[model samples]
Target: MTTTPDITLRSRLTTDCELHLPGDPGYDTARLAWNLAVAQRPAAVALPRTPEEVADVVRAAADAGLRVAPQTTGHGAAALGEQDLDDVVLVKLAALTGATVDPTARTARVLGGTQWQEVVEAAAPYGLTALHGSAPDVGVAGYLLGGGLSFYGRSHGVAVNSVRAAEVVTADGALVRASATENADLFWAVRGGGGNLGVVVALEIDLLPYAEVYAGMLLWDRERAPEVLPAWVEWSRTAPESATTSLRVMSFPPLPELPPFLSGRDLIIIDGAILETDADADAVLAPLRALGPEMDTFARVPAAALTQVHMDPPVPSPAVADHSVLGPLDDEAVATLLAQVGPGTRSGLMFAELRHLGGAFARPAAGGGVLASIAGDYALLCLAMAPTPEAVVAGKAAAFSVVRAMAPWAQASLVPTFAETRVDASRFYGDEEWERLLRIRAEVDPHRVFVANHAL
Candidate 1:
């Protein structure tokens, strides 16, 4: 049998908090995150039942001179897994799942640990939605704290840009409410700053009057990509911010439950989003529609149905994603991308998604939020969902090396969330932005109370 430690820390909290020891029943589950790549084992797992319980853990970790490596959900766990983590208390936030929506204000108050699916269902009654990821299972806390990307981001902006307030447990063990009027700088950093600042307990953010959407994807046969993708790129130049768009080159594996035309087929797929305010989205998208598709399923659909935009594999297969933000897609750059990962290549890759940027995504919000510097017109994202590790590595290298190969036109910086394993904060956020974030951390968390490590 194991015994509880005789430390002053655990005895100080007011709420009924539970601690999971090394060999305890829930310890493995508590320490485990969504990333299959991360193998983490914390000294103790603190499952706090209340905000004060959270503060207690923070206070105790500070007093014990231990840094905190917090995990709200596993959506952004890849970045977190690359740390030399030890003596850190894993603050497991699963029990803090409370949410409420104010329909009139178009806002939602979400607990620090809430998942995206919870928010979608809760906001459904109000005919509202907060900009969220395609995966319904992704975590809201982790997603927002790590710079939330969404299907609507091109139209509405990144998820972090919509935040109005955040309830945070700072490194000093104080529960501080950060908003525009209160601790304004910290609010800015947390919008896009990786969780290097503090542990967020709850978030209050704007929601949209969205229930229905003109969404879903159009899959085309592969032999036509050389004919298709280039013209689609030209149309991308004139697209309005109201429509978020992407083109992916995919080869879906043969299997039951997959679309008949898509299954066992190599396809040049064009995925689109037309944020309708009662306009004929099809008319706005006609040029690409004129390019013709072998299979088209574009029309009005439920917001929950928006996941089809990426047609991300519903199953968890081994995967590797390579990314680069593109400045412009002249014929040469576009052709290089198509030939490298597109249909004729068959380069052990699954899908190469080219998302259109610029427009509202590049414009600053009325009040500034998250990352503000990127004015790039496109983001080249390669989703390599291979069956084995070797394929993941080889595919990723070929894909991103092409990105580095195109560095003259690609943006020098990367979205910290999308960057894999090159932990340079400077490349993710420019030196000015990174320095400002560190300054805010110094003011709000002078003791360096949180743990943060990311790849560039």
Candidate 2:
């Protein structure tokens, strides 16, 4: 049975903001996410312009005996199951895309709805940069909340550590500030915790002093995998904290939308950024250079260009992704991965990646949030196109098999953003951390008024 929205609540929400029901003209468009596979169906959708407006919307939902779930860009929508979103008020904050940088303070105050691309452009002129994700179009709030893993992470730390403050509208319809000093508990809970405590409207984050860097991709045919893949792994063992890199094996189908170099090709690519000079990058990449990759694009580029170095899809596409954080990769683990998704496996996966993890990422901050460091030293992400429900199931199974083969080395906990599929709380937090998260959630949201894509 469909729950009809309370008319009084709907009226209040629509007075200053937008309120769209299932049958409304723009409801479908408002509910669409970056991943085209999941079709979102909420009881109602609201787009609030300001923090006060967001609080009002939450109050309205509370008054109507409904819960609230917020989405900035919906890049990680797979975690929101239909049951969790049912009778939930979906708050889309696309209108709150505002950002200001304090060049002297080396900080940026970004509205929740803002994307990384906006912040990169704004900070570039000042010679400062945020700990942005691989995709320029990814929303700042969602990425930061999930303890973002940035191209700069190996040098700096997880993006959450850079957060100075978060302006949040809590379940009680009260607007509050969360930081090291103010609303301290909420501050601790939100950094690595998913958006379960409340809706974040704005964030104050520390910026890095980086104007340019050496960054790009190197590609090789799959036939060279046996030699090249292991060589990259061995070289990564001695790589410095100044560099961040990942290796990906991809099969791109013929499509007019794809770039000529990538379309209808099966290739292995190494992509990353070295914070220092070109000489430093060349020295670090010397081992791989001996193999002579078919294509190499490494060069000194603006730091903003790091956002697209991984070549993440620039548009919405139908796909499913699975993840696993694993122990250090050895010859055995590398061979196991190849047996499942390599050239002749017919794995059906579009791409499989292994990100080298260590450096600042392995150390805990003085007063870090819930996730101090990922338990393992490397992370694997496998994705496949799923054009239909059946394809989604098959694709997910094939991708998971690769992870299962490496299960012995898999970490017990997952990096929040990496758990793109519908995973339970255990997959993201340790037993103690999980209980602490629940206690904090209950204390702040007694009525459980807010629901995140991945609930604790």
- Alpha-carbon local distance difference test for all models: 0.73, 0.85
Could you tell me the lDDT of residue 278 within candidate 2? 83
lDDT of 1 by residue, 312-337 (tens): 54543455566777887899887787
* Model 1: residues with Cα > 4 Å off, grouped in runs: 1-16, 277-279, 313-317, 386-392, 395-399, 453-456
Best by lDDT: 2
Which candidate leads the pack in TM-score?
2
User: TM per model?
Assistant: 0.89, 0.96
lDDT of 2 at 310: 90
Cα displacement (Å) at residue 25, model 1: 4.2
Kindly list the per-residue Cα lDDT of model 2 for residues 1-456, writing each as its tens digit.
234556466765534878877789998998887888878888788998888889999998987878888898888888774354667888988888988999999999999899999999999999888899899988999999998888888998787888899999999889999989998888888887868989999999999999988889889988788887888888888899888888998899999988888898888999888887788789888888888988898899988888889988888888888898987887888898888767677788898888888899888787877765555678888888988999989988978877788897787777888777877766676678778878888999988888888876
Model 2 whole-model lDDT (C-alpha atoms): 0.85
